[model samples]
Structures are given as C-alpha cells and as structure tokens.
Target: MPSMTEPKLISGNANPTLARSIARRMTMHRGINTNLVDARVERFNDQEIFVEVYENVRGEDMFVIQPTSNPANDNLMELLIMADALRRSSAARVTAVIPYFGYARQDRRTKARTPITAKLVANMMVEAGIERVLTLDLHAAQIQGFFDIPVDNLYASPVFALDIRHAFAGRLDEVMVVSPDVGGVARARDLAQRIGVPLSIVDKRREKPGEIAEMTVIGDVTDKVCIIVDDICDTAGTLCKAAETLMNAGAKEVHSYITHGVLSGPAVGRITNSVMKSLVISDSIEPTAAVRDAPNIRIVPTAPMFAQAILNIWNGTSVSSLFDAETLGPIYEGMYSSQ
Candidate 1:
C-alpha cells in the first residue's frame, strides 16, 4: 500500500519514455493520475543545465526518473539539478529512480591516478539533496557502499528469467548459462542455479581497456542452449566474441540478456552481424534508433517492476521479496530456488 502522500514523478531527457511508463504503472496501482510532474529541464546558450519545476511540490515525496546514459554528463547534471530544485522547493523526501546508473563500472581504482568515479557520482547525488536511490542492475554491487543514503539496487534477472523460462520451458535441460568474463560469473551462476542449468565461463585476456583478446570456453557447452548473462553491453565486442566462441565450442544457440544496453559505437552493427541468436535488452536506457531497428534484438518491459518497487519504498515495505524466487508470483513458477 502506498502512503497517503502520493509521490511526484519527474523526468530528465535521458529516458522520458521509461519515466512515463513508470508513472503509468503507478497510476494503475494507486488509481490516480500519477503522470510526470510539470517541469522544465533544459539547457542554456552556454550548454548549462537548468531545471524548473512548474507545479507545486512543497512537502511532497519527489521521484526523479533519470538514467545517466549516452550523454552521461548532461543527464547526470539534470538529476543533480532536479534534486536541488526539489530540495529548494521544500519537498518532503527526494528519491532518485535511476534505472541505469552510469559510471558504476569505475567503482574501484584499477590503476594509479585513476579516480573512483562511481563514489564521486554517489557523493554528487547526495550533495545535490537526493535522500534515497532506487536503481536497477548496477555494474558493481559494492557501489552501494559509496552512497550515504538508502540505495535500493534491484536486479533485472527476474524480468529476464520469465522470458527465458518461456523460451526454454519444457527444454530446460538443454540450457546452460555463461558469463562472458570472470567479472560476471556470479550473475551467470545465479541464473544457472535459478533455471537448473550448468554454468560456463569465457576466459579471455585483454590487451587494453577497449581491446579484447582471443577467448576460450572454460566449460563444456556441447549441444547446449547457452544463455549469456551480463550487466552492461557498451560496444558489445565481448558479447559477440563470446557468442562465437561458444558456438565454435559446439553450442546450439547463444542468447544474451544484458541489463543496460549502452550500445555505443558500432555495438548494434556488430550485434546485427554476429553469430549470436538474439540479444535481449531491457528498457533501462532509452532505446536508440539503431537499437530499435536491430533485427535480432528484443526488449523486455521493466516499468511495472520499477513502479511496484517505488510503491514499496514509499510504503516502507520489503523491497528484497520482489526479487525473491518463491515470493514473486507465478513468474518464477517452480524454478529459481537456489538463487
């Protein structure tokens, strides 16, 4: 149950469609007009970001739905500025509903003179008057420690698992999960255990940050329907390469479910001409024209999940159970217990 004070939903340019979908879901649950709040989030002549709230938000719980993707800096500024505006306007509480948290990949300092941008972003959010954060599928789970306020990090696996389950329903035994790199083994293993399948890893060496080396399949994938699970797919080189390696190692089909589809550079082009069967991404970062036009790409809706999460956070309820295998309604069915 939502609180008596209905929350205000605001949107930035990063992902307006997702924001609107979330608002629509909120209205469906609350039975009220919970559309996006009237606000002006625009840029100035000098490319300065400015946010002006048109409607009254005094003492109302505010939600800023912004995903810092593509043009990360501008979108990030919009979130900070919006939070500042809401705080200045005397909002009761401000929660940042960021579906795709950018700069999360830089959670740690891998080398000297490198900055932990993830922590910096967290600090910036708090300094801008954001009281809490609600985001999905962060690149690094440990980044939550960087935030001073409450951070609810949701997983997109449940949404993805439902579709995966349907695709492999009676043929679940032939399926196997694979993590393209060592970093995603936990994510892959979770899904593997969920659907009762084996796990595989793609062991590859990297010469540099943007350069990938030859990959080797760490586990057997003979005659298996391999499901590659990952967080972000920026250039998608690793994704496509891993799919090829898996197929070469005798995988019947290779399907990837990535949480955030950054899809920069020639990502869509590579995916379009890759050996992978399909690449299913969530509606986290607003789909670009290339993404929408991709032949083998699919999108799964996560607005309802986010809307229910917002409602739970507002009501001070358990947010973890929403991803729980046994508790998440008929979507999980009988699988997802070990995870």
Candidate 2:
C-alpha cells in the first residue's frame, strides 16, 4: 500500500534513464517510500500514442517525468496523454517534469507571421491538466510567463561550474566564459561569475536556419581557455563556428557547456572536427548513439539536482535557492572533472 504523503513518480519514454535516476535519488535523499508507477505507453497501429496507468493514484501527488526531446511532437503528445491519464485517474496533482523543454527556442516571434510555439505548448500542457512544471535551463527564461501554473526553471550551471573548477584547479584566471551569442551573455556571465573568470560574447549573424552568416569574438580571448555557454546545441553550426572564431582570435583552447544536447543531424560530426577541446552537456535529453560515441562530447547527469528540487517542492521549500552556486557545496567534489 502506497502512502498518501509520498509522491508517485511516473515516466514516459522520452528519457527513461533520467526519470529512473530521479526516482532513485528521491528515495535515497528524502528517505521517503518513493515508487515509480508502472505505466504502459505505446503506439497504436495508426501511429497514435496510448497510455494507461497500472497503479492507483487517486488523491495522491503524481509527477510525470517526460522531456519533449527528439521526435518532439510524439514525445510531447505522450506527456500530454500521460498527464491526462493521471488527471482522469484522480491523481491529486500532476506536475510535469520536463528537463529539456522542446520548442522553447520559439518562445517569441522572430519574424512577421511567426508563431510563439512555446506559449502554445504551455497552453497545451495546462489544458492537459499539468498543475506545475519543472524544467531545466529554458532557452528563453520568459517562457515561464507562458504558463499560468507554477513553473520552476532549473539551471545546470552549478554542475558545469564544479567540473570547470576541477579542470582549472586554481588557474581559474586563465579561463574566459564566452556566450555563443549576445542573448546568452547573461547565462555565460553567471558561470563566469561563479568561477571568478572574465566573460566574452560571440557576435554572430544568422541569415538562415542552421547557418551562420558571420561570427566575430567580441572580447579578448588571447591565450585564454574559452568556454562557450549556451542552452542547446541543435546542429552545432553556431558552436563550431564560434569555436573557430575564438581560436582565430588567439584562444588557447575552446570548450562548451550546453544544458540541452539536442545534437540532431550532423552535430556530432561538426563538434568532432571543430576547434573545440570538449563539449559538456547535461543529460537533460537522452543522448543519441552519435552523441555517446562522439570523441569530444561529455555528459553530466542532472538528476541529483532535479531530485532535490522535487523534494523541496513537496516540502514547500524554496526552489530558487538551489540555483545559488555556492550553496551546491561540493556535491560533485571528487566525482567530476573536465574530461
């Protein structure tokens, strides 16, 4: 018999490894009887998704862990259907835990007649009975406004900062954090501030999708190890181009810390051939085989942080405090290094 005080964790197929990790961490950290609710999520012959919850969730707090990653539409529909199933099954509440919120890049309209798909997705979730959202490093922070329900946007900076600290190891001055674009300056600056390093920005022009019109380094990177920070690395065109630009401007080496590794298409090949020394990404999205096989790519698990946040939410604690870089307190002490 499951206790009513414990939250039931459910997962869709989007990123099963991360979901299971979060459940395990919840058990280990909270000392609560955490259970991963078994559910059947499959496809019908017509390519429609079917979801059925196998356990009773009536009046129990329920959480659905599903990242809208590759096959974005299908995965998204699965989340919606699962949320709907939980709501209809009389679950007290359904909090959608989407580590990598897909379509977040389209948070706003870049051109005339364009759609704000991020808002649309938010509305869809709310309509599907999602009472809350837990996501990591949204491409645009303002996307939180799209949801009327509480949305907790988590960061992977602390995890990256720990690894960078170990990698630099008392030579942090030689490192310069570089934002791949002007928009990411804040994100890069946060990491730089945490590591006590200088910050730079990459000024780039994009004439079309998956293409870089021009790229120029905006700050001094001469002989400095540059680390480019961004939220996603979809095709790796911008990252590869920015790395080349940094090297041309006299950077000693270039690395990247991206939150979501949506490395679709030739992203792995591009990063492998680029001037970048390494590309570190959080396992927000389940990595594809190419991402796993790439020589320069490294993955850091985000489940521990997420598990803590879930516990905090259930306990009515402050979730934003988790973003404090200093408070993370050596959780990765000897376990992480810049590979």
Candidate 3:
C-alpha cells in the first residue's frame, strides 16, 4: 500500500475458519507478510460480549470480518463493538466484511406490525462506526439502499458457475438450473445463463409459518439434470421438497448450489435422506459437525473471491470488475495456483 499505515484485518468469533482462509488468500494475492489483527471477542459470565484489540491501529485502514449467522444477535453485537473499538483507536477507516449478512430476510414487512430488521441493522452499523460494508449474496438486493454508507454486495454466481462446469462437464447438455421458488428466478436465471443451460422455477406457496410448503415446477425437467440455485438454505425443507418435485416430474438427477448454508434444525438429516445427489454451499457460514459428516453435503471455498474483493477495496480499484465473468476466471483459477 502507498500509505505508511498498514491495512489491518480483525475478525469476530463468527466463522473464524472463513476469516483465516480469507487472510491466507490475501497473503497470496498481496505477497506480503499480512495477517489478521490480534483481537479477542469473548463473553463475560453473564454472556455479555467483550472485544479488545491488542495492537495499535492509529491511522490504519481496518477491515473487520464478522458474519452474523446462527447466533445473529451475538455476532452482530461483536461487529458493532469491534467497529467502535477500531474507531476509538484512531483507525483511518473501518470496513465491515460480512460474508453472510443476518436479518437480510427481514428486509420487508410481510404482515402488519412487523419491522424491517434489515434496515434497522443497517442503521445500527452506521451508528456503531462502520464506514463501509462488504457483503456477499444478500437475500434481497434492495438491502443496499437501507445503508446510508457505501455497501458493496458481492455475488457467488461466478464461483458456483465454475464448480457447476467442472462437476457436470460430461453432461453439460442435460444440465438445467432450477430456482426453488418464484422469488429466486433471477438468481437461478443468472446461473443458468452463465453455464448456457435451461432455466426452471418452482412455485412455492405456504399458508403460514410452520406449515408445509407446496412446490410446483414451472418448466420441464423431464430427463434433465436439475441444479437448484438459491441464496440461503436454512432448514433444507423447501430445498429437499423442490428436488423431490423435480424427480417426480422425471428429472434424471437433482443437486443444489446455495450461497449461505444456514443449515439449522433438521437440515442435514433432510438433505442426507433426500433425493438430491449433493448440496453445495459456500463457506459464508461455518459448518456444523453434522454438516461436515453428511455424505451428500459439499462446501465450496469463497476465500479467493472475498480475498480479491478485499484487495481491490484496499487498493482503490474496481470491485465491480470481479463481478465480470472474464475478470473472475483468473482469480478463481489463481486459487488453485497456491494449492
């Protein structure tokens, strides 16, 4: 960096493995002796969170990595407190790297007397000293408008497209991408177009919470290799059901590529026993023991992508370039260069 102050990375307790992987990729990309900022985010006896940075960050550009996943409230608190700490320590800048942005689903009000928690979170981050936000695959794109600060939302389509190409190389002609519901048609269409495959949608309807969801296929999946695309896979109920619907409609096989694997409750069990061939999720959220042990579950590393984004942001380069397919190829390929 041209500046005398070094760029610093600080991570919270959420998804430490992903934070480390991103740090490693940053090392490879920058070719400098770089590491995460020495910090501790622990809980007190009453479960109160505490964050302390063990270094001088005066005038340094600070990047805080914390994904508000399973324990959304705790992780969110840690992020806010860390940002406050960095600002108080005289850090020149503080950018929030939230791989899996929690409360994204609550972007809109579904019923009366409901709050848009996504907007509230954005307000809280800004008030807590966050200058910028770097997130991946938000549930709703419009969440960006909620933030008054600059928000760079990254997509995982290119990474997933590369894996889909490599995994279904031999049967490219038979592959077709399926969106689990009408709400995901755009995401599914993007992936389908990237790989030059057909597109389908599952019309999902639910009467209310805790009720069984009904799914109906929109396009022909007969004798086709179905690949379901979605942003978050929470319980895997809808995903499993979508796969079953495709199979019942005469699909040759079924697979899924989800960005955030918020695999809570009986998610692992459902995917394991479902008709889907495999479930591919990004490392935005840390995997649980059951998730790792599941035979049908696979994780795709997003460190290289996040790492490149971080570098571009630090260097004042074009982060949007990474979204371009032609530009993304080299970075994704570069990931294997180190391995």
In order, the Cα lDDT scores of the candidates are 0.89, 0.89, 0.91
lDDT of 2 by residue, 207-291 (tens): 9876789998898899999999999988898889899999999999999999999988888999999998999999999998888
Question: What's the C-alpha lDDT at position 63 in model 2?
Answer: 84
Name the lDDT of candidate 2.
0.89
Q: Could you give candidate 3's per-residue lDDT for residues 284-306 as a string of tens digits?
A: 99899899999999999888888
- lDDT for 22 in candidate 1 is 89
- Clashing residue pairs in candidate 3 are none
Please give each candidate's TM-score. 0.95, 0.95, 0.97
Q: Candidate 1: which pairs clash?
A: none
Question: How well is each residue in 1-339 modelled by candidate 1, as lDDT tens digits?
Answer: 657787889999999999999898888877888989999998999999989999999989889999999799999999999999999999999999999999998999998999999999999999999999999999989999999899999988777777787777787889999999998999988888777789999998998877886799998999999999999999998999999999999999999999999999989999999999899999999999889999999988778788888888888898897786444534333333333
**Segments of candidate 2 deviating more than 4 angstroms:** 1-4, 330-339
Stretches off by above 4 angstroms in model 3 are: 1-4, 334-339
Which whole-number lDDT from 0 to 100 does residue 156 have in model 2?
A: 88
Q: Pick the candidate with the highest TM-score.
A: 3
